[model samples]
Target chain A: MTDALVLLVVVPIAASLFPVALGGRFERIGWFVAAAMGLVHLGLSATVAAQVLESGVISYAVGGFEPPFGIELVADGVSAPLLVLVSLSTLGVLAYARRAGPHSNAFYSELALLTAGISGVFATADVFNLYVFLEITGLATYALVASGRSPRAALASLKYLFVGTIGASLYLLGVGYLYIMTGTLNMADLTGAVASVGYTSPAILTSFGLIVTGLLVKVAVFPLHTWQPGAYAESPDTVSAYISALVSTAAAYALVRIIYAVYTTKFLDEISLAGDALVALASVSIVVGAVLAVMQSDLKRMLAYSSVSQFGLVVAAIGLANETALVGAVVHLVGHAVMKGGLFLTVGVFATGLGVRTVEDFAGLAAKAPISSAAFAVLAFSMVGIPPAVGFVGKWNIVVGAVEAGAWSVAAVVVVSTLLTLAYFGRVIERMYFTAPEPEADAVSTDGGNDAVEVSFGMRAVVVVSAVAAVVLGVLGSDLITVIQPALEVYF
Target chain B: MIDLLTTHYNYIASILLFGIGLYVVMGSPNLVKKIIGMNIFQVGIFLFFVTTGYVDGGAPPVVGHGEETFVSPLPHVLILTAIVVGVSLTAVALALVIRIYDGYGSLDEDVIKEVQVDD
Candidate 1:
């Protein structure tokens, strides 16, 4: 009976408008408003998760208009964790941004809007509403990427804009076909409609191609990932962390939704090519993304490409189409968000305090900025699939699931992906610990005197906290599975 | 052939429009032209949705007293929202193009890339 699901989106959006509409009287309104609303949002999403855990799925129809006619917001085992993750990460990024900040009211507004859009993407049950929210997320992302006061950031943002628009448009076209064929916009209704229309129809085939391609572009799969590196590399560190953690995570979530909910396992049973192509594509992304990550000298760009690969694993798990793998996909999604985002924040600390933006610049990082370097090492190892870390748990589930399914090739890729991950992250770790510092350079760059770099307490805490969560959440994966079991059973 | 062309001409036109837009977006070097192409692409997709709702001789989705039939209004409403989203995208794209032109004195992405490389 709680409207928490709707308010999950509405609260942030409502707060987002305040800094713009009423900020003239108040000075520096963005961070306060964002932080306050973020806290409320975190609490609310936690409540929603608790409710969903106790009572199956919690569905809130907008304006109390019964579903199928009006939009319905559902929080179940599937969406509840992601809802908490989205709000929690938004608040975390806000905390990191508090000290390391663009701190403008407009920036906070866009961040809030992005939060709202992501929550909507997670909660909405209607296909068209997903598109609207997707665009909202994209639009907010482009503006936020451009919020960095540099020309390259603008260019990168523009590039992201064009690619993202096409991706979204293709999705809209898919929806058009779906509507034309089925005449219902609701996801649950579409599941029945799609089956009744038959899985192998030309229209259904076209819808699949357009819809999956559209989402793949957003997810930044293999060749479609051109805009990603530039966008991640050029944006301000905080903004990159926010988008990197949430944007594609939400997109991947949508893909899982459409595959499991709208199309259903029945669709996969009929058109095996859909699942096969996804597996093939994700495997390619896994290998190629790691290769690209190894090739990049730019640290943020490397992280961006790593994301392409991590998401590849999730996509592949979904492609595997088993109970264990699907759960593995969800775990990996959350694991990557925590580890990758923490990596970005640590990099931000490196850049702000020590002017280290490139991999080569990370030389002797342990000697100068030990805390940040240590935090980076922890996240990097977690990302490299160190056992007992959440990353390892996710990889293990996917590999085991792939093996159980007798998809030997997919299983091999899921296993080999660990070594591929290490190949890139290993270099950074090596540089940090094994190399000697170039003396007199570090002290001059951060401050004009002979003093250590000024890495803020907040910056250090966030990095440490995420590194800690990377391990702690891993140990709690079994608990996570219990919470997710109900949602998984219903979807399957 | 002629029968297929006329009855499904709207779909054909929409596809053609999309192809043209795609070509312009991919082929052109001018950043603004790319944005224009993007706009055309969106409008093309909008037409595709509108065409789906078109019923033979059905009145505009208005409900009159005891009326039994009308065109589907759902896609139309969806497209309206999409059109607004499209507009905002264009605005942001133009703003970015302006900033790039200001920074590098060129709207050609190749030239901008070159300058960025040199820097």
Candidate 2:
């Protein structure tokens, strides 16, 4: 039912409180509650996606209030994929976190809250409502990042809180500007209201600047990405994989929603500066992210940097603003989340089972943990744009989209960044398969030795499943494009 | 310039508050100061939203109050929600700061970084 759209956000939020309320007696029960809620959330997300894909965009006014006055929850092709991603990643990460954990009622509660926040962001039709959800996501994420054992995690989380709050506030300020100019907060209503004010108007331009800039910080695009690597690297492994997959992905998805739904392509056409700046930053992020990723010895930090590059492609696709490019952006967004999240989980398996946390520690990993190593290699190669993997599918679409839009520079960067991707992932692959295990690795292994290493069935299954999904989704790329086409038509 | 300032003094003041808050957050070495700066920055945005909802000689937006010009109630509602969000964020931030202080025995950002590296 269309009403399921609101349920997608509301159910998780209400469920999030249960874990904390039952904390003292049911400490370990948090995972079970979260898992159960995640399943329900996934079902709700699927129902919404199916209805939207079958029909068109599904818009629901909360409590039967009409749009442009009361808040609206919307789900279309764009949101459907992200909604599913948020739920799926939540479920997947909970599986991995079952054994590898800060397994507190509090942690699961935060995870459920994050699920609620991200789903809310995807579902909301009001700009100010988007801000509230962004904060909710921000708060949950900051807490999760701090949930790590180290004091460093608290510092990383604090830094993230400060930067992330500023970004969200800036977005709110932009909403304020838009509200003053158009006297409306609803995305659908603001589209017409913004156009009537003229794209070239100073207020409209300022709002666009503020909104996009704010979101870019959340997306961790290049220069604004300072809080990301530390947050990703320092957090508990489950937290890293979960946030790495969904948080920035949700923010980037919001970027797409705002650009297409509210500003429309006409604004980009009128203002060359806007599109150019986005493209420029994205290009820089791609190159710099890859370069930094290659320089990292820490595996988690490497993946964090790699996310910056991958999201660059997504943002670049959004900036290209063509039908094909937008398709590429969505495909890449989904692909990157799966691939990167899988990679982080795989790294966690190594860290937990083998005490291996650095690129150097990856040498001869295939011998000890064949399944995870193979999965890691598969994901890494997929990230390098190997065929039949979702990563290659996403990159191919983005490159084709970039060329179609005459964005030769972006296309070239897409190609070059693949090689840059290879440069980083390749070394890990080489270490995994080719190099001999270090003689002193036994001394270096955090758990004592390879003999003592014991990875749970759940952790191994999730990473392997993600690797398989990356390949399968790539094969089904055309079907995905077909499903999303109708939604794209409404905008382009 | 004077006329513009007179007409939009609230806007100007809000912008100034925004800039000052940002400067303190970025420029200060103290951890607590950063959180204070964050609150100030949020308050600036709240002020801007409230200013936008204001109307000259407007009555409060109460149902059936029968005022010809009533201030827009939406922005105020949104700001109320944001203020709640801001308070939660501050609470979480200070909790982290306390943990950080207990761990490293200092509240200075530079000192914490130094201690962190030494760890």
**What CA RMSD would you report for each candidate?**
1.8, 1.4
Q: What is the Cα-based lDDT of residue A184 in candidate 2?
A: 91
Per TM-score, the best of the predicted structures is 2
A309 in model 2: Cα distance from truth in Å? Answer: 0.6
Scored by Cα lDDT, where does model 1 land? Answer: 0.89
Q: Residue A267 lDDT in model 1?
A: 85
Q: Tens-digit lDDT track for model 2 on A373-456? A: 999999998888999888888888889988888999999999999999999999999999999998887577854544343678
TM values, all candidates: 0.97, 0.98
Q: Grade the docking of candidate 2.
A: high
Expressed as tens digits, the lDDT of each residue in B6-110 for candidate 2 is 999999999989999999999999999999999999999999999989999999999898989999888899899999999999999999999999999999999
**lDDT score of residue A431 within candidate 2:** 93
Q: Go through the candidates in order and give each one's C-alpha lDDT.
A: 0.89, 0.91
Query: What's the TM-score of chain A alone for every prediction?
Result: 0.97, 0.98
DockQ of 2: 0.94
